[model samples]
Target: MPRFLREYFNRNGVGLGSVMLGLVLFWTIGLIILPQLSMLDFSFRPNLPPPEIGGPKDLYTLENYKYLIFGPEGGSQDYNAVDLKVFYRTLIAAVLVTLFNLMLCYPIAYYLAQTNGNHIRILALMLIIPYWINEILRAFALRIIFGESGVLNNLLVGAGVFDTPFDFIRNDIALYAGLGYAYILLMIFPIYNVIESLDRNQIEAARDMGASWTRIHRRVVIPYAKPGISSGCTMVFMLSAGALAAPQILGGPSSLWFTQLIYQQFNDNSDWPQGAAYAVVLLVTCILLVLALMRVFKVNMGDIGK
Candidate 1:
């Protein structure tokens, strides 16, 4: 670590390296560690009211965590079934959204990276323009579009695809689509950056050797883009899991995200400890998923940083 820092200083100059190092340390400690420590503390402690009448006393206990697995009263076989289902759905939906983005973005990223034209700027702007609006607004836009009487259904009906409007927003499809659209840039940019740096000669050579396009991508391009793919997948999964607004706005009655339960704990139930516990569980889940992906992809922290 010391040798790496010394090299960084020699390469980037002492003053700049010192500033960058300090910023990174500050960000890690201030933004990550301290807030998590605070949440951990909150998670362990019981939620207590003011010391007025007969209110619950403030004390550290594992009850909050237990309540998540067991029933609300604890030690029951029948768990918080709704909460458990929502949590499961949230994780599954996040993974699905990540896969969707990978499938949707990979071809586009490849095309964009390989192409050299003025239309690239226009296409990039089209992606960026939607995001220039607020995220909540974008989610609402999707809601409007997917609603029963909205533009999509109207188009389908008008084009004789259906006799009546289909309810897209009332299903999980809209939720996953919204989540994928929400993080499109994150998936595309990382993959594009890596693929753009790959030597075109390798692809040409493979083509010249009568290799199929799939073979070229699978053997040459994918291996080269593994780090970027891993990083993008990690980021998209984390963001999808942690996202609050899109799920709330775009989800139907059947789609209950775990984050919504956490929000209810904090706001509606006024149970800060339980909320903190839920948040901690989510954080741990995301971290574990990241580690698992790293192992599966043979990627390291250094590759993710790049």
Candidate 2:
């Protein structure tokens, strides 16, 4: 067992620790790893009818993967421009959501973590109360808020800020906003948890050394919050990238999400291998991005566990 597990066992004793350990193993292996392995296997295999699943006709091939590039039958084109465009756009949108949440939440996290006040509880409640609702409900609520005649636009128009309601949904504003909002908590709490652990004396010492607020944060706060930052970024990015509901609910006519394509392969097209292939592509890309972010943050998996 790892040190954490050993420590956990010591604290909880054999019986309770064994139950927790079993649950963790079951969730990790039975739920996550097995499904992923199944999908990966399906991705490599050709789509076949139920009777032909294990028949001689059912041989593994790269056709499903190639289908993403060239369609069902290989065409003599460089690539499928539309699908690839959507794929790249989805990635960009996910990144934007991650960055948006980070920028918006970091200041709030700092305030909540560092400030001392009787109002902190109320402020924290105000921040958190909204997220008590389901993610889908929140997305729909955002749709209502950002629609042309919706709450925000209506408020602006009634206040004479605009002569007419803005086309936020049609303009793709709602999609981005909803994506960012959906994952905001993921960014905020991780940052808060890490920043809360930082010693106040270090910050005070830096201030006494005549460090400006910006310089103090740059040299002291952000560096200390690296592990939390990494965890938040990773969770936000992965969830944003894999999001289906937000995109489906708030997407504009031009806003085609990559997951929609994967959904279509499984449902509309009924091509399991093709769907698995698209899913595998997305999964691999997300893993690569996580690795890249970890590298950029100079954070190891062990640090993120902290």
Which candidate number maximizes lDDT?
A: 2
lDDT of each structure? Answer: 0.89, 0.89
For candidate 1, write residues 81-121 as lDDT tens digits.
77788888899889989999999999988988888899998
**Stretches of model 1 off by over 4 angstroms after superposition:** 1-20, 52-57, 74-77
Candidate 1 Cα lDDT to native:
0.89
Candidate 2 regions off by >4 Å? 1-14, 74-76
The RMSD of every model to the true structure, in order and in angstroms, is 2.7, 2.3
Clash counts for the predictions, in order = 0, 0
> Candidate 2, overall lDDT?
0.89
Candidate 2: worst-modelled 10 consecutive residues by lDDT: 69-78
Q: After superposition, how far is residue 173 of candidate 1 from its true place, in Å?
A: 1.8
Q: Candidate 2 residues 225-276, lDDT tens each? A: 9888888988998998899999999999777789998999999989988899
